[model samples]
Target: MHPATATPTHCPYCALQCGMNLAPGRGESPLAVEERADFPVNRGALCGKGRTAPALLSSRVRLTEPLIRSHATGRLEPATWEEALDTVAEGLDRNRRAHGADAVAVFGGGGLTNEKAYALGKFARVALGTSQIDYNGRFCMSSAAAAHQRAFGLDRGLPFPLADVPRTGCVILVGSNLAETMPPALRYLTELKENGGTLIVVDPRRTRTAEQADLHLAPRPGTDLALALGLLHLVVAEGRTDEEFIAGRTTGWPAARAAAMAHWPEHVERVTGIPVPKLREAVRMFCAPESAMVLTARGPEQQSKGTDTVGAWINLCLATGRAGRPLSGYGCLTGQGNGQGGREHGQKADQLPGYRKLTDPAARAHVAEVWGVDPDTLPGPGRSAYELLDALGTDTGPRALLLMGSNPVVSAPRAGHVEERLRALDFLAVADVVLSETAAMADVVLPVTQWAEETGTTTNLEGRVLLRRRALTPPPGVRSDLDVLHGLAARLGPGQGHPDLEKKFPTDPAEVFAELGRASAGGPADYAGIDYGRIAREDGVFWPCPTPGHPGTPRLFLDRFATEDGRARFVPVEHRAAGEEADAAYPLLLTTGRVVAQYQSGAQTRRVDELNAAAPGPFVEVHPRLAESLGAVEGQPLAVVSRRGRAVAPARITDTIRADTVFMPFHWPGEGRANTLTNPALDPVSRMPEFKVCAVRVETVDAAGRDTTPSTGAETADAAA
Candidate 1:
């Protein structure tokens, strides 16, 4: 029973997946979290969010029983597990019967375990017979993933381990603020500096992470594409291009080089706000080293042209011959906890298990064989995350929805409109640990177990699959998401008038993982060789382990790229304007991101008193220039209006951000919901929403919506240091 004392587990917040131990708590707390030193990633350092994660386990804050919307009162009330499961099943079945199987949709999360993600995808295709399925992860790193696949012919967050950071020659960090988002991981960069490696941070804000960089490039929001192309331009002009490696290990260098040549230093300087001299310095630092790496996060990815932007960066790496070698290559700093594993399984709309393309006949046949179904019987590819959510309640869209582990109301771009779409759905069912803003609208809300109360596997950003053991039994009336899916699958499969459901989904995480492995065999993210026993024995096993005796691959592309010809493919791309630019009406750019004390959507962290004390609530981070123009003062409400929607939060005046941009933490709902102001314009390739940059106008106001001159003081400038 895990010794009834301490259970080693990984943090449930970000993709870093810091290791910790959960011991039995003395009083109301469910467990006490302690740092685990054996894990190579963090080395026993725990973030405040990880330390206070147990606070959400208390029944006083989270939902302890199933809730059903009453027909009479139009409000949610307590209900039995059986009743809630049956209600969800009937709701889904009724929608399918009326409008066909495509009328019912399923939305998943990035935090779910590998088993749950597999089962959830299976339940949607096999049990519900619907192709309308997607997940919130599309908002996290889809652009980087798309670009990674296009260039490397494979996508695993990082090609090497976090330990490689210290040994690299130079590391270019794009958009990610690891010091605040992933505090423990900041040590890797510190060690890099200690090891005499150079650090370049590219961000619009002079964040806590930017302060540590040897060189900081502050480009305008959504201008990352221009910045990347400009760097490549300088590389070509300075004759830093590795022609030998380009001819030996890469393809399509001619078109890529020619496209980069068009963007001169002066033109790029005009396009992006970065100076020409600073651009040359970044290129010199990057090319001076024998081996260097470029890592990107949400900054460059959450845009309408995210794929091409990431591709521009990859082009620079390939022109310099940094990829497919030790201490080098391009990598993505995925934000979700299991984002690596989540997309590897079938949760993504266009993918089957093992990162296989849904349209590929061989992939479909392999997975269908594992599921005991005909290959042609499975539905074709479906809509992307934002597309699926936008289509909800429409004539050609889904009428009923089943959601788990995500809070789209607070997280989705253009959140106000998303809420309207949710309200229009014929039936909605949500399963989460707490009654998130999205869960509050569900006709049936299922209380699911949290991280400490469950046993599962999560693949970190390093593509290392680790196990999280159950530290304690969940409170009464709470069940795991897999169990809920299993119960609903039984009710909705081959019963009443509906038939065709032939597969049985197991509730046990281990059994589900075994099935997932079998289904994923021979695919890009092959996991056939990994098992629970091996994970415990190895601490964590890297993917593409096709057999029991074959050692897991830690550093991919060391020998050859995953492409058919064993050479990296370079696709030519040019920088373009943002989906929405700063217009006269909305003369400022608005960007959204996370805070240290609050995780995504603030569903769990907002409930923790400690985390709340550290970050009381959402606020608009306005630069001194913008604040002076708007007469905004700290601690007073400031309204941000966009073409999509309007939101307000207390102004936090600081000079850390760009003069033409404002920052907001997207963890709260109501007036402070940053997603409400974000643009839903998606990338043509990745379908990632433009969450990072959108045009908005800010005005000083009171806590109420009424405009007013905020109280003037000393012009507070305290933000992330």
Candidate 2:
């Protein structure tokens, strides 16, 4: 039978933004994924996670009411929306009155819509007047964004569209496993190969994505910088360098060339463990093509020197005349749903709307004018994501935190410590669709609407802004995130001395978008010309659209770069050791990533039976040789210990990974949370933590029922439960 009328929209998972149709239909079949063949990004393709996303809307797993912790019983119980909002306002007010404005902190996420991110930032700066605000996107692509801005003077996840991927001559997939992370995107690589374009995958393990590459270089974890430098050296040595392009369109080539020349094939072979012959072959494969592109993801961007690491890769593109041309450039494979737009608006700590720097007086004045406040009243930039999380509840930190749409308990580096900081907070309020591990610890939990039940805009990895039209009505007692913010603003605004703050926080998504456009005008990520009508009509509008009649930009830097002189700048860099390295105490390197069946933090996906059955729990992937050396058998529990903490998970021995390295997926909580063993070493430029690599040790768990770690989603009882 043909389903009832449907709403054509995009998926709510990754940055690919795969288009799909949601059929609200009728009772017992309220949600369905139908065919949507028109959208260009994914061409109606959906992955397993997208196919199973409707399962998350079931009342059987999602929260349907507001919850407040009772003082007498000390347990979270159902409460009216008014009561929950009032309590949250009082908690935030009390904390602010006692300590200071900065005592009240706000934490946001990459999954939020453009309107919500903008409103959240305005709420922090205008309503509560606090500087302590940041989002999870900092962990996702800050390094790439930093590198992009430094080189091109602008930062978009991908400078060009995905449509160009199939036509490019060669693509160097750096540290991104698109085959497993976003299966629908892997088709781009497949199409590139079909077009006679060579594909090279660089990673520490032979992942499913690497299996499809013409050449796979499995370097030691944290040695991506050396690997990239070595390829550039070979390009120069082979006389493959585009001297004319470097001299005309780029600057700082001499210093960058000197840096690459210092790292010869033999020296890079010792650092990255890729052999001298493989380096020469990689250079030949990359330079032989008329046009090539370099793309990086979390693998190289989550290290201590992540910004410079990405910079090194961009140098290769500039040296070979690949950047700022047709079908060739440098891009970042953004991982989160709205990671590209999350920081582009105002959610990040150091940024204002339109990707403006908070430290810039002109930027502060522009955003402040839109906010209807004195520019001097605006607070300065605050701590980054990891730094903000580490400072909670301390004498030098905020006492109360309002966290929305993020679950740092499961996703943050050093999980146990972040949880401890959460517990130390005097007042904690969370707004989410489910009682996530982090939300379960909050004093008040506000149930919010999901993607299918909300109308908003999200900028995808291609810088295309797509509109997600609401298909189904939200369950009773639950409201959209905008409504939650509006209600809180009404109660907190007057007390914070703004009598009309509630008017600034609109419950309607379109109205919020209009205001966001004004705030984002004349900035890097200009959205002045784009509105709800334009976005809905155009399918998706690329950003920097300054006027209503102007067509959005699909490709950047084609004619000229976004710099002072329209020339890309190259910063000289050298390879350095990771924040930590495997020593005698920790003989193995541990790297963490995501699974195909689960999304970030596993908050909503873990509630789905199908996804859970597909990926029941987290486990450690060990090399066959390393497993045998540790006296571990397949499925045997093994305890992985680091300087911060210990986590135990069943072992799955495989030769896909390096013998000296092990792998874990960080989508779980408690004992199996790979983040528990991660280090919080911050990159000097990007402030991104070293989550991709850390030193660790493995030990066989005693089978005699001794102390053992609990599996994912099997945490101890909480007061709310």
Candidate 3:
């Protein structure tokens, strides 16, 4: 029953991880993308980025050689893999000998394959004996991760399967831009809206999703917690609470209810800048008692109070007893391809594999056994990403750092500070597929294979683990991230090599998937009995497939909660202001986000000529009234400055943005990185910086200056500060 020709497939661009088939065409490369129907997430839908992935994959800027920076002249020169690896090993060894294992920190990216992520964490803890490791997932979804673990005992990236969206009655989207970033997933929204289910959206900006909403609540930035609390108050006040569900399957009701009631409609209206009438309407439409769901994304979780904000959404779900029902519950909109899977497998600072906390002794023991190391040998949780960077700036911190697949200089919050720290490092080794801004300052740059050249597993937005197969081999001299780590670990010490490394870290992804399944057996995200053979037999299995004969779980919390008492407890949230606020001195609120033409930090999409031409350079979006007040016109250059730093970009006059605030995309830097003007203040709970809000003042570049419309043939020229 073999097919006539082998089909080439790869995960779609962006975080959805929707699979695609590539049938070779006339004059096309061996791995040309061809969208196919029947993929669970996409169902044949593709976005601008997904359809144009070929240009990105075959970009001319892709790095293919190992680069070594000369310590004396500060110049990067090409080197053989042996020289690069040897230099990196020597630097790491020297760091370990000087400041103990804790002094060496490792930073990972969410874009990496699961095998590479798992290897990075294990490599740091076992071979190098350093617990100072964390990933960029902290900035994207740590709040969601913390809340999901507390409520469901395990965080499913997408707890409910994507297919369940069409059958749902109502959807409450908070802080998610599915319409633009992930246009394919919006099919369910369109279907639900067409079928008469209310589509309520809450965000600071009236995004495309908000514009299509039956009700859109434009709350001030960082006031989401207040609105969520008020919504719960209304649900309880209107007697819409599901007492039967709560009584049968939940705990901690009294405290949660009292706390929610503390913020009434009028109280929250004043604090959140959402009108009382609109707040009442949103709650009334959402408390339908059946087929109601609440979803939160980076909007709520990217603030300084992200954890509390996420907790507010979770508490609202619990108070209304909307959880554990079909088409109902709290859903997190993850930002990376494998952000959920990365957090689940202990890539975060405070967590272990399986969403287990670092302080959990039993979980540590289990993971230690799986890693083939003594439980006591595993160091405690290390510093978070922000804290790690701050530490690097201090004299008594890590002098050497290993960065993989991340461009922190342009991506991190308060990037000016991060750039300073990067320059301060005595030794830095970067492993990536390209020479990113961060790589330009590294002591050693290891050219590593990208997603299309690697085979592994990545859990999608819905916590569905799928196989990511390689259809094309990497260019010569480029190695898989796993192989690079393996080589580095083997050279670390005389006897520090992984015993099962050969069997588990093979080039074939099936073996790695088997090892992951074995480690996950009987655990929270159990996939023990489902191996490559079983998965191939079926199309793709969802998590919790504990045994061979069992069907995968499509939805969670159906019968009972994962807690010991079979109950989901509610955690109350209080309103808090952003870390920075607008005042007379700093009159306008500055916010940052992604443009449809670019992705995060613009590391990949900017390389695509067409997409880059569409969103050429950094620009400040201002309402017409604000532009007039500042003596600015369309295409005019403007200076946006905050307490941290300043950046100059062209001004666009549009009513799409609020008059009191300015919007800018964080994709471009060296010219104008938004992080330069962003607040680095950490969220009290999640430690995520406030990329969403800061106080700033804008000024026109010239008294009679006007903006120039960039043509498709070129990008906007960078303005000299």
Q: How do the predictions measure up, each by TM-score? A: 0.97, 0.97, 0.93
Model 1, 1-721: lDDT tens digits are: 2236888899999998889999877677868888799988999999999999888888889999999999999999999999999999999999999999999999999999999999999888888878999999999999999999999999999999999988999999999999999999999999999999999999999999999999999988898988998999899999999999999999999998899889999998877778899999999999998999999999999999999999999998999999998999899998999988998899899999999999999999999999987788789889999899999999999999999999999999999999999999999999999999999999999999989888999999999999998888887799999889878877887663344343377778999999999999999999999999999999999988999888999999988999999999999999889989876677778899989999999999999999999998999998876687668778889988899888888899988987778899999998789999999999999999999999887878755578674422122221111
Task: Please list the C-alpha lDDT of all candidates, in the order they appear.
Answer: 0.90, 0.90, 0.76
lDDT per residue (tens digit) for residues 12-112 in model 3: 45668876775443332335567768676787777777666656445376788899987677799989999999999888878878878877889997877
* 566-653: candidate 2 lDDT, tens digit per residue: 9999989999999998766776788999989999999988988889999989999987766655667899888888999989889999
Candidate 1 has an lDDT of 0.90
- In model 3, how large is the Cα lDDT of residue 709? 22
Of 1 and 3, the candidate ranking higher by TM-score: 1
Residue pairs in candidate 1 whose N, alpha carbon or C atoms collide under 3 angstroms? none
